[model samples]
Target: MTKRWHSLQNDRPFRPITLLPVTIAFSSGILMGFAPAPLNFFPLAWVALAPLWVLLFTPSKAKAQGEKNESKRPFFLFSFSFGISFVWGVGYHGLALSWITGLHPLTWLGVPWLASVAIVLFCWGFITVWGAVLVALWAWLMHRLESVGVKGKGEDDAALLSVHASTPWHHLEPLLRSLRRVLLGTALWCGLEWLWSLGPLDWTALAYTQSPGNLAVLHFGQISGATGVTAAIVAVNGLLAEAWMNGQQLAVSRQRSAVSSQQLKTQNSKLKTIALLVSATILFIAVHLLGAVLWLQPIAPSNTTALKVGIIQGNVPTRIKLGSDGIRRAMEGYTNGYLALAAQGVDAVLTPEGALPFLWNEPNKLRSPLYQAVLEKGAVLWLGTFTAQKGGIARSLLTITPNGATTSRYDKIKLVPLGEYIPFQAALGGIINLLSPITENGQPGAFHQQFDTPFGRAIASICYDSAFPEVFRTQAAAGGQFILTASNLDPYSEVLMAQHQAQDIMRAIETDRWAVRATNTGYSSIVDPHGHIEWRSQPRTYQTHAATIFRRETQTLYVRWGDWLTPSLLVLGAITVLFQRRSLRS
Candidate 1:
């Protein structure tokens, strides 16, 4: 028998999987991530994770059919992850951030054509690769948790441990068993996202994918912050994944049974149908219930103050934003927008990041026009510009008071990895001109920047700083009543505009602050405390509007406590992984 089996194994060619699941995994990861971007068909995010369910079953299916589950080599699992990452990277990060290539005359100037393209692609590649690794890590954790859930006893000590291994759970009904996956998957995914959602590599959270479009879903930001919303979205995806896996396993069990094919009528179908129905219903209740608790219509505290401010969009072209001509043109456009808003009776006007490009030797030279505008209108002016510091340049938000005094300046704290401040410039500077010596690099500033405005205590943010919730939370904790952010979206396409708008909306919801965003290209908007988009500008359009923004002294639970969900998730995931590993080994 051994000889026969050996001969049979040699005779049959190996096939761990066919092309279908492989295609499914790649397509699902990319599509799920892409749904959050330009097209924003948010519903797809729920099922987008279903393809990864294949990974969970592939090994078990192979085992049940008496095929090798897969090669035991350590690298095989990692290589599988590499494939997952490549496709995901191509579809989501690559497409979402392709605007990096539009860095234009500067990128194109300092290098050969191919090198410039490479420079643009470096970030997308680095992030995609990092994301791929994280996806693989999530898969590993999922498997570990699965083992813990279904296998309480050692695989070797199989003394009829349960009625059956194939059921949704050995001891619980299908609904309860499937709910376990929702918990496990949500925890594991949140753990990984928490690890990455900081500093330079911090580009996304599952919550942002559903933003503005799903206002009810977004209110989760108020309680658990973005991580909570992310957990909820991932949980729905995970339950669906479990349903797919459980259904496939059930079919495999039926196929392998010795009874006649027609004897068993797929007894678990009703159970599975109910489980799915229950899971979907729970998610629906969750979103709306949380929305009601954290709705934008929170009764205004007696201290709530309303400030009408002007939001201006310059719509400057990418090439000119940094050039001398571009600088003058951006200022002229901003001046006109400021005047227009001033005429409309706004108390203050906010301009997008780099609305006034600072000249090399004269750091405050651009302040003249802003000072003049503030003095003439007798209204506050918040404008974005770059200031020359000792080492390099710092992106700053200057608050020009009505008395012609540029009183408050907040330099941007978080800098972009490649675009704003190249990593390891010291080592790479000597090698192949990596420093971009002529280019203005940024210096990190204070963690929180807040000022007293005519309306209330206002906080300021530069373009990318708003991506990190802690930045806004810190300011909110420091008594900031309203949030003001400035951004220049000229180099990128409309995809970034939407992606960025979603992030600012989340900040507004998280901190319960009325957020007003000013953009050089587009997507300037006022986001209410409940995360609703009160008013937003179109992409690449030169427009300005005054919206009544109420400043709230009340802070939300998330803003007060900071991100409690992520740490709790990390702890829960660690215990599960350790317990499962021990159980499996024993």
Candidate 2:
């Protein structure tokens, strides 16, 4: 009877729950959202993972002393499906991706108002929950690697570092184990992040949360892409976690404390020294600050050239953007802004995506006023329009020369999953059309980007292209002097616009080129090489302002090499996994 009751207790027929980990992990996810723009609580990201770390390392009663299967699993006592990891995912993405709710109206096209809201909420929650699951899985990987590093033989007692007191390995083991934990944590983070960047669901990179606000750490992004910044952040977080775990242990000399051998005394001293070093590194940001000066500083004045670039923000209404008839109003707004900017003697005038409201080839057919007016002013006009491709229309940058001729055309490579191109149109197409009228697909362009402009050789990152670092890096490496991004963020909230601009700032700093944005709705701004905003337009405003932006010929470590650090760390992680497996077997 007692054995049966004990077995049933573990099952918990009434309710099987671990409340603290669930609540804490979920709260940590909410805090993670506040680290990025619109909230801009920049400090939240540093400590956001602390709760989850505690969850991973803390010894629950059931976890510390339990049956073999229960104690042996990663995140002990927390069953995979019933654990706090999934709950954390819910809390994290719910707040971070609240923007999904705005797309609810699209579903009304096929269903009733109430039904649409229900469907939208279901979809939004489902997606956020799914993403949260991925994050939880990643946390499990990190904790497993950490456990394996500490316990030499994983199968034996599930204790951290089971060592004979007199063995020399134990003396040096503490220090090596701590360092290994940090590396393992960092590598696991980068590896999972790399996997996330593979497909249409690649928007939630943790590195973007650090940009434009975390100035001290932003310098690392210059040498490496955003991944470099992420690695540094993860390393610091990992060190802090290690410190929390081993805060009680102190180094003791045999002569001063007890009757230990001299060799053991020296080993303890070495262990203490290592702990202090790790603590100092995490608490101090000196190395990061120095890297900032060496790699982040802008080019000398003599080596740089400046151009007067104008950004046009036309606050087109939501109704106009969703309707075909709004093309006239959109064109009129862009034309007036273009001529006024031309009057300022701007070198080039950039308009947002869909500024012209028609095809580049058919601009004259819509009685297009800007093409001829811009040519008359002798300023290069770069705007977004549909360029006819082999199969369909490509969302591209249409660059007009002084003679009103389309000399350069750079097509958008990365298309938004549902917005630009609907995947598997034959099957998902009919279903998607019922939700939103987006019937056609936008064809993807080739990767090589080189745009010829009168002012200088520039590159155009069509709105969606801003998210992918490789797109802009390729342009910079190919001798792109200036980077211009054109986005048409109509009907989206200020939160969305700021998120997009935050990404632009990182691109500017990474490429060491001033990034000028021209958005149709708002938040058109210029970010310099040092990640400073030169000038910005207010949200939902119709105006054209020109900022003097600098052009650079130099290529940054990130721009030249492109995410080399991630691969290097992956190799390190593979080696750790090998040793960990071997230890587990023994």
Candidate 3:
């Protein structure tokens, strides 16, 4: 059986018609998608990528079989790797981002039902393809590096094809090469994630997969934001992939080798595998140990006092919330909820984004009964309101005191593309009109804006703003005490809310600050500095949740350095690859 398997592998190239690679890649992606909410089967994240890695790191069958079509081999392998990667990406992102379809039934925007469906699908497919393209690029580059000897050769290629295995240093070289490969592959993955997060669509990071589970590993976020956790994940997956590939390659080498040298090769292979396994195990343990240290680190107390805050969920539907009658209903709901919560002796009351559904400086807002109620109850309110900006209106979070004065206002900086504004408006503005009501794109706020509340200085994030860690990190670095994120998730499902909560949890751990989230229609939550969801309100409910969240001023390593680990590793990998190629040529 072993002889037959080895002969089969050595004689023929990998056949795509068999569908093994495609199936494994697609299944792995689907399995990995469950690592985050709402499924949250996070253990899948560790092993799901192993199959893909095995396929990626295995010696290209074309080269192994001495194919005559040398010109077509590179493009064939590149295209094959990219196709498999895109399939995997499709499965993973398609499952993870299925909630995007909740934006359907866009008749509210006067868009035809067919056009609305097309728009939503376009958004979903576009994002999924974008994410998959990144993964494909990473795989292609990783494969290119492997083939060029930057990451070294497979066990069969080194031990069977090459004469270097006869050298005295063969044993040590195999282990060293495996170590370098894992490090380089992991670093490149981390770098890809880091660069992706800087773009407009930054959702669905690998780190968030552990956000819902694996609290121990999730603690690493404090070291380098989400990228730290991503590095750890990719490292483990790469190690597993390497181990699997080595075993397969070793099996093939044993089958084809001469009887006398077989024993020596077998023993040496065992030693190399054992060494690599031991090294991998130690590396994994060290990651968790550092995470434990950071997780258990005590956050120092702040001079500012804790604030008893109230979060109001109005449960208003997206369509109705904009209508005249819906406006009255929402106004009444927020007004009543605020008064009730303030009457309960809460220090301040919070509302979801667009609670008032009107311009901040408009007469409708200035004449709000809530202003009088704030004075009557001596309460401070953080109202998510719209404000006039230079180009258009800004989604803003405003702090209103008992005196009806707007003390501090934080305009949301990260506006949702297409949802808030059209991308490349110069070219596509005339063609895209799904969101016809929004004739002009919403203007984003300045990045350096300060957020001050009656309780203390706070980091204000409005809805989509929470997805970007740099936003919160910048505020935290500037001495912002606590995080306050207000979101309006009326039409979307609880999946989005849960995912948003996960985002806030990671932000909390990264910055070592308490996070308070206020959302319309569900998932109003308060997360502690330790990434614990202390209190979470029910979904699709009109209610008020009050909790005492402390103001924290402690700056974590991630907060101070801001995602430095991955980029550093990436640079190291580049330098190593450059030098290795130089040495090989000389």
Candidate 4:
């Protein structure tokens, strides 16, 4: 009777029957949202996922009951457990991406006040829903794998015998089982993150939560970019989840055991649970310790090459910049800032994206005082301007020599979705107006556009391109000495600027190069190869920063290997899962 009861209890799914678990999960997500920029409560991220992890690691009742039928597995997707997991994702994304609402009062874009509010809300809801849905899918996959793939496989137990045939491996079964679950969970998370990175909206990556803080963990990016830090987070969370699951099981075993042998088994389980908890704590500390070692390692010196670069931040309102009336303010602000920085003896000056309100070949641009100033300063100048191409307009950064000749140009490749160009414009253009100044879709630059500067070769990214590591990694691998990211972040809140700065810091660490950012409204900064911010500008203020930044040709492991860790882990996990199911059928 006791054995039968224990089996039944183990088979029963762990459900969020009460409001407490659901509330805790949601609250945890809210806390995690603060782990990234603006608030930067990074420590919360280390433990915030525990409740969600518990929910995901526990098998749902539907899956526990319907083990034989493949069709029945879909039932778990709609289970209450999925709802709980999704709620956490919503809570996290809602707070983290609150800056999306900064686009309010879009009257400047010819949008009515009420309509603007509705549009912003719709965008927020859509993105939040998409992010939350991904989380739910992650949880569902975890439950399905635990329930169907490896649950009752006898070969799993004997598979380890080749390593320790004579040892009492049965005594360590619980520990091994917990470790296997954690490994699988970590791999699944990394795979999901990789998928997210490929898309246009990738600001919500788990690793970004650690940036501008948690330097120890951020160092892991040097080896595997943001994916490595994400793997570490998922692994730690999985360990804690396993520990919690074991504790609950041990308590249940104590209540049900009656015979001496049963009592002995219960005591062993208790001992194993305690051991697992202790081991998990140790592993967590060890990961951070190793991270600290990596963080403290000496940064390789620049090859005797340094560029005194000046970054100009023009505090022009987005509304005016898009209008014809704001042309004077935009040109004067950049030209004046450039001249001031030039007087301070900067070798080169950089302007934020769209610094010149006119096209690159516009007659007005050549007549402007900015061109004459560039010629007189005899210093290299980089201008963020539009170039008229055969296909359409191209957002480009033009490099001008001391002789006032356009030496090189790098057109933006990763255009902002909906903001720069509307998708399915043929269908949606008539109904939905993006209110963008450009009527036609901006043309993307070639992927391998080489940017040659007076100092040397440099990696250039415009605005949204910084979010994609692959964009910078390829350039860095091609012997690019330094990184420059120019953005026009007008109208967005300072929170967005801070987040943008964090992304650049990660890119710097990943490529082992110094990064300089120039933005229209604030958070222009310089970052070292070690993910340290040397300088940052005040938001919504017209400011210029001139600093000596090094040019580094050193490529990090991530840049060389190119995000191999996450994909490799995903492939391995997939094979293991397939092997498990095949063994079950046999």
Candidate 5:
């Protein structure tokens, strides 16, 4: 069996070779879907790219022929397949939800399916191109390492040969040079994340899925933002990849030495390999256990006065939401819900994004009614509404005091691209109009805003805005103690979307602030400062959830420092790669 496995590894083309990694990647993704919070700590993200690494570093005709015709097709196919599989595993949940909810029912059929598939392909195409770039970079670095005479190949030459005959040192070099790569990669990924946060479709992220699982790690997030979470994810994956590579090398080396050496040498190598594996396993277990312990702990609010808050899920349809009557209905529903909550003696009432449906500038039809309700009930009202700003349409969350005083407004800085505003709209306005829903381009808002309540200052964000850590960080820094996230999830109401919504628990944990998330069509909840869900509504339910609010504690180290460790490692990683490449050139 071992021989056959080795034979297959050695003979297979890169396309076929990626099968295991792809399978593992997909399985990991599904596992993430099942238990997104706990299993998310597995560090399986880079495993998706394992095949790409193998393909690029493997001894192939392309490496020898220096740009042969046959190599091009195989390389492209390998990248394309890997991209499709990886992206499909990562993003198919959103697609499935889109279909199930009839948001794009046509997508359930041929045309939409093809279009969705094409979109996925287009997104992955960039990833594929990036992978190719990384491959070329790795090759250059490895050649440098070899040229500089980095010594000590482990006894596992045979196993390494099975994977990549020529670039046997690729794995070893990356491990030894990990510090540099970690630094560079961390910086690069974080920078990219920062840029991606600026995009309008704001909520999607690798760390968001893991938000609900571990509170302490998330507590560290309040200070660091999602960048901190990203760093942790990368660290675990890098460590695991290193450990696996080390184990493989040790195992192969021991086998080779056993065949050719004295009994003592064989015993020593075997012991070393076992020790390495054991250490890796121990580290992995310890990290997850620590995270779990942190997650399970209860958050003690500073004040006990416990404010009663009501979250109204309007469940307004997107098409209606775009129209005037839809806006009126949303406002009416929210106003009615607030009145009902006031009758129940709720201290405050919350509504989802675009609860007013119509742009705020539209003649004050809903405002007077909403103002009257707030004044009569003497209950604070937090509403998600849109406004016509100088740049374009802007989404905002407005907090009205019990006396009907409009206390503060938080404009959503992060806007969805096609849905809110087209990228490069000035140049591609025509194309964008045909493809997107933004009849009038959406505008970006200020990064942070706060509303002063009788209890304390509250920070609020619209749907996509909650995904960006910087917004929260800035708010927190500006003395916002509690977070109110208003979202309209009606368009993508699915178990997956619910799961995705639950990920916001991490935000609470990261910042040590309690969060009241009110969404359209369910998944509404109250999260404690520790990132645990105190209470949540059922999926697809147009109901109101009432919970006692809590105050945030002091800021964490992560907040003060902000992804310091990860970014440093990334810089080091980049430098090491560059140095190695230079040495090879020399």
Candidate 6:
């Protein structure tokens, strides 16, 4: 163990220059963990590129002497370190919170570590491959800038010769050269993001990092689904790298000129360095301004129905959720809450998942008086419950119309792996303890479904279903102008859990639909069509707020096409990588 630790330590280089890249990468990852809840921002996103810049710019003395290929190893090491530290900090922390909530502590510890390793390896691999491509592109730009011939008469010829001694290649002007690299890099990053969206890890976009604070930048998301924000983040990182490189080159030139013999060489290097910095600053400012304008735009609500909605937050403890007596108590609590909301002149009342507590098919089930009361009050009750179906067991959102009619039912598409249904349960058998005994194991819904309400056509998503974007998008495409997400987050999640869960806000923005999230414990929020939170209940609290939300008939680019831009971008990014490799070979 001691020897293994020593080997691992030795593999990780502790150079001062490497710290910048690691810090930037790790900080960016940590920021992603806090997104879409309450504390979201893009300013700190600048730090995300620190590690990559350091790795690309910092020269290795060993590689310089041609003694060893230190470049390849350092890139991998830097990427791994950055990915591990950042993902572990951000992603694993939530798993720790799960452990404290009494989930098999061993499962929490094991699962989180495994997930962290998988995520870190995947992200690091992406950075390593892409970072190398960027480096080659930068080198090509440098070469082109050096090739730019003389421009201004005899003085231009003299300047060209002097510049060539230090920088070389006079064919490519400095501004044009920088612009080419920036454009290419931005295009590549955007493309990669688009392609990756088709995969299971589609949530890894830079926009997810800002989810916790997306409300502030809601307008920007309407045009682009977090991809636009990612472009800004990458652009900022590139600019920082350009600035740092310039400063380093200038300092080096000054030192060389002080030696007297290399004054001309030093002067030329300084000029090139200044030119690069100026070009980089201009590009950075332009992108920043563009992002600012998009972010500052107002997102107007599209629907004008003005439906009075009520949310029931039954804070039932996990231990009592499935027990016979516990089921009675859970039913009583939800029914009473619904009745109270009905009295408040609410058009519809919402409840968290499994609010019924008991299995819907259970014989001689207690019919609560709240159902009759809802009918009498002329209010629609949207209740999250469980029902037995041909698919085994399904968690469903049942709509009870004002006339006591069981009007519409939408089943949950995405089921929680362990909490709802055990994975590989047939092979594992009794090794896994089920969270509920409603059925042998709860099954996933056939597909996403939308229901026409008095307010408008609305789509329903259960707790775990909100995590998947494609599900919500399908519902929106099927004419769901409004979305209702019912979740019971009390048993396994924390207040901070809402931060991670806010990824649903992106769905609202992506689809241009108003989203109402009613969680069992807390985080009941009204997310407007543009993904902005109009109102939210306090976490871990039993509170209800009646806020009016407007639904939009207009579809966003993402909603209309669904990750089409991302896939195209991915192809273009791949082509850029190929071009970069070819350029490097030349």
Best by lDDT: 3
What tens-digit string does per-residue lDDT give for candidate 6 at 1-586?
Answer: 3233223323334433344344554455455334433445445555555334433332323212221222335343343333334333343133212222323222322345554455445434543344333333433332222223111111122233444434445433333333344445565566655554443233345565666553444344555556665665665566566555545544544644366545655565456556656655675566556545654546664346566788877776655676777677777777777777777887888888888775564242336666667666777888788888884788888888887766788888777544576667788646654322223577777675677676678878887666566687777777886788888776445533465356777777667777788887777888875456678776666666665666656776666676554455446545544554444334
Stretches > 4 Å off in candidate 4: 1-18, 59-63, 66-77, 152-168, 300-303, 434-440, 582-586
Q: Which candidate is the best by TM-score?
A: 3
lDDT (Cα) of model 3: 0.79
- Which RMSD does model 4 reach against the true structure? 4.1
Model 1's lDDT to the true fold? 0.68
* lDDT, candidate 3, at 534: 90
Q: Looking at candidate 2, what is the lDDT of residue 7?
A: 36
TM per prediction: 0.84, 0.86, 0.92, 0.90, 0.76, 0.71
Q: Pick the winner on lDDT between candidates 1 and 2.
A: 2
Tens-digit lDDT track of model 3 for 21-99: 6788899999999899777898888788777777655654443433333224747443555667878889888888888
Write one digit per residue (lDDT tens) for candidate 2, span 128-150. 86677677777666555544444
Candidate 5 residue-wise lDDT, 47-123, digit = tens? 43333333223222223232222235534434332343344335323332232333443342234566655554554
| Candidates, ranked, TM-score | 3, 4, 2, 1, 5, 6
Model 1 segments more than 4 A misplaced: 1-18, 58-82, 104-114, 144-170, 173-182, 255-273, 296-304, 359-363, 432-438, 577-586
Task: Tell me the tens digit of each residue's lDDT in model 4 across 1-586.
Answer: 4343234324324433346556777898998899999788998887888778765444333434534343265566545556777899999988888888998877776778898898789888878877887777777677667655566543222232233335566667656667767777878788887888777677788888998788888877878888888888877777887777666655655676398966766676677667767866887787678778877878756548878999998888778885666887887888888899999999999888888766878576579788889988876889898999876788899899888889899999888766776667779876556444336578778887789998899999999888888889989988889998899887889899999998899888878889999999888999988889999998899999899988887778898998888878887777767765674465
Model 3: worst 10 consecutive residues (lDDT sum):
63-72
List the RMSD of every prediction in angstroms.
Answer: 5.3, 5.4, 2.9, 4.1, 6.2, 8.5
